[model samples]
Target chain A: MKAALGVMALAAALVLIGKAERPETGWSFRLPPGFPRPRVPADNPMSSAKVELGRRLFYDVRLSGNGTQSCASCHVQSRAFTDGLANAVGSTGEIHRRSSMSLTNIGYASHLTWANPLVDGLEAQALAPMFGDAPTELGLESAAQLEARLAGDKTLQGLAQEAFGAGGLTLDRVLKALAAFERTLISGRSPYDRYVGGEVSALSPEAQRGLELFFSERTECFHCHGGFNFTDAFGHEGAEPERKFHNNGLYDLGAGAYPKRDQGLIEHSGRPEDMGRFKAPTLRNIDVTAPYMHDGSLATLDAVIRHYEAGGRGGEANPRRDRFIRGFILTDEERSDLIAFLESLTDPEFLADPRFGAP
Target chain B: MRSLLLSLALTALPACRQDTSAASLSTHRLRFIATLDGAAANCKSLAAPPFRLRDARLFVSELRVIGPDGETPAAFVPDSRFQSVEVALLDFEDATEGCEGDSAEHTELVFEAPVSSVRAVTFTVGIPFALNHQNPALARAPLTAGAMHWGWRGGYKFVRIEAQRDGVEGRIHLGSTGCEGALHAITSCAHPNRGTVHLELDPATQQVALDLGAFFGSDKGGDKTDCMGEPADPSCHAGYRAIGAAGKEAARQSDSLAANTTNPAMGASAFTVIRRTP
Candidate 1:
């Protein structure tokens, strides 16, 4: 009996040790330089089968209630996953309140949506576009409906079996697969990245000057839109989650109110002081993800720069505006240099990569 | 491990026996019906030919039975997918006619209160701020229903009533607006937007009439405006007033016109106790 108990104790210890270390096999991430491994939820572990299945589902229109749209409808690949619309038009032709955000390095986002701080997980965030009815993106009503639509497809079923370990197609499985695939969308091969990697000739002289201006105290561009992912709201394995929203002084109807239709973080926070505050989206693919701002109000990089230089459209009167957005005069040459720097951050290879493309 | 198991077993005993403490509490079922011009309206009755009821679902919270002794909070039983101890979703659409989704019609609020002569009923017409702004993906029961989840707002729609007339659709989607903070740790809401409702109940049948006509307003056949609780939208004035959201900033938004004209305090008149004939 003592020997049997000793064997059981050893087995338990081995299991605990195995779990404490990094996963040895099954699915491993080919993370880029200066990038930490993303924090994957234990419930939905990383798997190659799940990623493949999610790639298929991400582009499948049958996942929608009307069979007219899918996740890809608004999140196009070449455009850094943004539809390039001022407002994202839903599958049912309903216009969304906010612009479609870029999915570039979305796995690193601490909070999922443009403003909702509680939507910290990609699995939970997937439900918004899939089943959300306010401006119905995918417009799917129920999981039963989704299951019924994909039930006949043998390819999805086989993939689901391999991905989920013998379970038939499920909504939970679908979400996990999508999140798994999204975690693999790492873009760290831009000119800026190359420059930081010690390649002196990666960026032009003008772009290097622009980079200095961006990080300078005058522009203060690097405060919210800083760090590896270029957005303060970044998280990873064992990293502290930063859920930050800022008011770039987009509008002030009377007080610090934004457009009534979409008032940024204030709509979620419900605080008077939080008016017009919105998450600073990553500048990773900002060149491709325009017109800028929450509403896509800025038409081009030049306009966005000018808006920032002028201390936002609301002017200095806006009390709730982020202090970093204080006005600064930028010469025409300096302006183009900054734009060059922003453009250099765009990874052309990542955009055209078939891995993220439709199957 | 044996001592730990014994302590856990000791803790579990009270939870299992806790149900017995509520044995004296009597179950009270309140029937709520949608009415148009004082007539009971359903999806079957209000098809596409006339004014079609697209959807009508409201969250009733903080329900209490006002008796002679005092007010006692109604302990809502986990009877259906439409109810929970924290809040109850009173759905009026059966997903027929003009209704959009697969929503089962549920228009009852059943709760357990002490056995006493109930004098009146009081409840809020929306969800509490705490329960309203959480992640709906992780919500349970009636909160799990997809049709009521307002993702962009980071909260559940407190009240959703949609109707179509003469090819024009009118909507009243109410939720907490100008809210501050993250989802789980929301600090405050500028406009709670909840309507306070109180009514004297009949001793026999506790039936309440949800006057849809009042919600749509007396104006019929003309252009009916929608209100998503935007302060700038003047269309929200009548609907907010009828729901008795009056003095709250939720309704005070359209009251920008109040500077010029005198407007009476809005009372919660959308719901009223009906005396049923035997």
Candidate 2:
């Protein structure tokens, strides 16, 4: 009996230690070094179940009213989550006012939508495409309709409950799950990242020279698009807040109009001074997400370079152009080098990675 | 066991002390009413009344409360600053128009009294300097979601008053002038063509009057014109030229209308004091 009691005591102690050693449950996020996590809403905490559910929802066409479009319709995973279209078309066949932005590393974005400054998080952004009256995408105006739709599918209902727990399948819960999934879609394993992480042979000679020019103060490309993400307006798991908008002299269409279709931040703020200001997109896969700017007017990378080289469109005569857009003269070889460097940002492995592909 | 209890007790002592200190901070109630003039008062009512306005919205921003005792220079806490305070000119049902037209409407703003030694209150007629300098995409609440945002013009309209006369609606849109796009590269654009109005608030009085006629010249004679849709109308620009030589005159008139007015104090009686109950 004495021996058995001693053994039981030892067993209990070992069990306690094992319990302590067990990793915490739910989702745990560890942002890459030098990367910061964007601010998450207090209501929605990140969880693995919710993220998995949101991933499925993001790819599911059933979220749309007519079951025709999903978040992936405008944001293809192959092209760094940005569709090749100049302007995205809604599920209802209405043309969007602005170009579709790449969702790569969008978890670190300070502002979510193109023009709306109020949409600071993914949860808020999901609402616009879901219920916004002006050019509606998913016509989820009634809660009953959403509930019935979710209840129609047994698998989706189970997934929603597991993801949202006692909160049930609500609009807010859907938004939270979608946001969680987006937060997990972190992409930082490019060759450039490897080069920055101390690998000497990661970059070609031309790419290295291009990187130098990019970082150089003379070119000043790094001023707005700097740091690990190549965009200064980055917020992540632990980064300090940064500005989300800049006037890159994309348009000076004269007489206080910013190219009728693409009003940029002006449409949202309605401030005259805010006219023509747009969020600077991340250059993670610039080679894939072509037709740059809020309007997607520039088709080729060379055209974008030339536009920056000559200040802006409508010539040096535009009175309303931003000060930073002073037309800089770039040599032909230098321009090509910059293009090569930009191409190096593409992660071929990321494109072919099956983990992110449609299941 | 005794030591564990002591440790818990000691850890909780600081929190109790902090709670007591936070409870001691004084809070005050603020109340005031804005009076309008000219078409402002008339616009509130569909039926024509003397000294009435056609559109009765009041654009107020940068609310600063002076202590109850006297005017004290206080630093507005960051993120606590307000941009534009809007009092709608008309009240309408979800889809249909209400019987009552635009009248002098009352607005309420409340904030924790920063300092105990309260005096009077003051506020600017336009957005605060800090928020005004920020990118419009980042501005939230009372700043971006207002009629004052004149999409891409680059500045907040300090005052936006609209009125209709002789089958033509007149508007007074005021903001920073001499704005030369974002690419000018200069730190300071030219000074606003117009000046700002400084409002001194007396909580006891609970009434403030703003004259509306000051925004325009005599509507009876000298070519009564409209500034509404002036961006597209060459004739409107021509009319402005006849009114004054440059846009500076219009801006100045807007400033005067925003600042000094005594005629249309219609909503002063309805002013409600915002006070925190003990």
Docking class of 1: acceptable
Name the regions of candidate 2 deviating beyond 4 angstroms. A1-24, A30-34, A255-257, A314-319, B1-278
Clash totals for all models, in order?
8, 49
> Per-residue alpha-carbon lDDT of model 1 for A37-143, expressed as tens digits?
77888888888888999999999998788899989999999999998999999988999888999999998898887877667778767877887766778888766
For model 2, the docking class works out as incorrect
Q: Estimate each model's TM-score.
A: 0.78, 0.55
Each candidate's DockQ: 0.28, 0.03
Tell me how large the interface RMSD of candidate 1 is. Answer: 3.2
Model 2, range A109-138, lDDT digits (tens) per residue? Answer: 876666555555676567567644234455
lDDT of model 1, residue A6: 44
Residues B135-194, candidate 2, lDDT per residue (tens digit)? 332455445322344333344555554444444545555444433323111122232322
Instruction: Point to the candidate with the largest TM-score.
Output: 1
> Highest lDDT: which candidate?
1
